[model samples]
Target: MFKILVIDRCYFTRTGMESWLNQTDLFPASFLVAALHNLMLAKEHIVQWQPDLVIADLHGFKNEIHHIQQLASLFSVCGDGIKVLLLESGEDAQLSDYFTQFNIEETLLKTASLDTLAQSIDAIVLSRPTRTEPKPAVPLLTRQEEKVLTLWMEGRSNQSIATKLSINGKTVYTYKRNIRMKLGMDNRFTPFLSLPDAIN
Candidate 1:
């Protein structure tokens, strides 16, 4: 079953989106859901329930484009396989940076067709590629260091990893920095994802 979360401040607006999805039979597949008014209100639920998609409104935030990028990244940081579908007002239609930075699954105008929204949501949730192929070991990394590398590459935040590994967050950060250096990675983001692909 696919899990979905809706984050919208306006009660009627939230219900309307939910009703439209249900009326369209949007995701013929199963969907378990939860809806809340804001990110802060539902963040813990997100980590615990692990929703497959998050339908959110960017209009609620300040400097909305940048906020959207960070919001999308939060899913990754929390180790949730949550794809984001963002809604924007017409005044701030262009959000290319969000696409480049976090690569959100979809973005639509607040006034978009329900059919389009359904297709967008369905496409992302159903078309995900599974990590079935065996990945070769990184020759450059020690087994322990590789543990750190794997967790970071999977997008766990430092504090999350610290708790998981029972190490200090600073140690996780140092390990991350070292892993980047060993990988010849000059900047954050794309290189970490690319290096593993190349090795595989």
Candidate 2:
């Protein structure tokens, strides 16, 4: 079953997306949230959830390029098989440069109808290619850790993710540190952005 992570600060605003997903029969899996107060938390959350797909709202934090880069890094780690959909209310032309830099697969304007959004989700999930081989077991993550990584990819913060998982802040930090060490991101200032670029 496909797993989804939704990242946005205001849960109320995401009602349309949530409602649409619930009413759809196309997806056999489920979804969860990893909301964040700021960009830093978002990066931390991605390392925690490790979701199959990420749906992000880029409204309040439009200027935070690092968060976008972190999302890009998660996409890279998951390979092209995982899908990421960006939700925004901005000019298409202006997002081209940024989308290219991050390799974003698709974008849905905030003004789009619920039907369009549902259809877009259906298309992405249905078109996902099957993996040729079993994905290598990522040593750093337990099942819970992987769930956290999925949420992290959606750009939620430590505290926010912890709340979603019913864990504490300190435990979340421990997992973040472990993930950094496991991914060899301990030394980099902005490891998410730097590591993906280095590997490529």
Candidate 3:
């Protein structure tokens, strides 16, 4: 079974992608399309449901590269290991920092047809390579990072962690990015699924 998560604020975009997936001839039986309008809600599902691929609409991401870069980076990590497919306006297609910093699966221009999107999906999922061996274990986290990740897993929001630690919420997010990096997790990750083992 293939599970996909769609993140887009537009109702049409969300449904259209789902409809496309359903209608695609290349897609075999046993697929699920889960969607959320924004990243906040999607974050929980990405960690819990662990979708096979993620499709995000980056309509205005260029205006806020640093913040969006942080989001894209974390989203990339949260996919367990799968890269998020970014959809952007072709006008925003200029070479940019976002393109340079992140490992997006595929960048689809808005001009791209749903059929094109489906084909990209078919290509990525069907041709995905399998891992033959376990990756090296991720190194331990800094004590500060460990604290933040512990609270994050405990269902605390970034603001909550900031208050608890007397640090800025932005700093907390940086810690999250770092934690994701240190874990070096792949598609097989179940965030906090094995908290005791991960922390120790």
Candidate 4:
């Protein structure tokens, strides 16, 4: 499910956007939305919830330059995989820098049609490559990583593996992390298949 955060002081606009997106065919049952009024409060929510999309109205924040900059900084810091859609009363040249610097991709006038809003969202959300369940496949491990995994499975300590491999202990840990990522395993102890027969 995709999480959406709608930020606007105007209750009507905030909830209205939420309702329209919820009912629209673009998401239908896919969106989990949270609407808020304060930009400061929204910062806390953004850090905790990490919403996929944020639809915010800048009209209410036009007078608060610090708050606007703060909002932009918040996004710039932890905004990976997040899409922002800004709604403004008119084109504010001052905001162009914030938009470019922070990677805020979409900006629409407050009076824009819902269709236009939907199109912007469509381009942002639908164009992203959807993540699917990982399938079992032959893991492409480097020779060094395979050696580390072999020693790891034999219950060798990181220090022992490092000594045997003539590498630093931290390098052993790095190889293990890479191995787990390649296998899509969450923890060091998760059970996974052995190396393919071709490698044996």
Error of 4 at 196 (Å): 70
lDDT score, candidate 1, position 184: 52
Point out the higher-scoring one by TM-score: 1 or 3.
Answer: 3
Q: Model 1: per-residue lDDT, tens digit, 92-166?
A: 544445444664777787788877877887787776643333232223555556677656655577777777788
After superposition, the stretches of candidate 3 with alpha carbons farther than 4 Å from their true spots are 24-26, 60-66, 93-95, 129-200
What is the C-alpha local distance difference test score of each model?
A: 0.62, 0.59, 0.64, 0.69
Q: Identify the superior model by TM-score, candidate 2 or candidate 4.
A: 4
Clashing pairs in 1: none
Model 2, span 1-200: residue lDDT tens: 35555666555655655665665363544444333433444444455555556677755456655544544554555456457788775664544565666656678877888778777776776676433343332234466666665566566777777888999989977876776665556545644423221110
Lowest-sum lDDT 10-residue window in model 3? 191-200
Q: Give candidates' CA RMSD values in order.
A: 13.2, 9.0, 11.5, 17.1
Q: Clashing residue pairs in candidate 3, if any?
A: 80-186, 81-186, 81-187
User: What TM-score does each of the candidates earn?
Assistant: 0.52, 0.52, 0.55, 0.58
Question: For residues 13-129, what per-residue lDDT tens digits would candidate 3 score against the true structure?
Answer: 789778877664657534567766534446655766666678887564344333445465445555447767777654453444546566677887778887787778877766555
Q: Lowest summed lDDT over 10 consecutive residues: which window, candidate 4?
A: 191-200
Clashes of each: 0, 17, 3, 0
| The candidate that achieves the highest TM-score relative to the unseen native structure | 4
lDDT for model 4 comes to: 0.69
Q: How many collisions between residues are there in candidate 1?
A: 0
Query: Top lDDT: which candidate number?
Result: 4
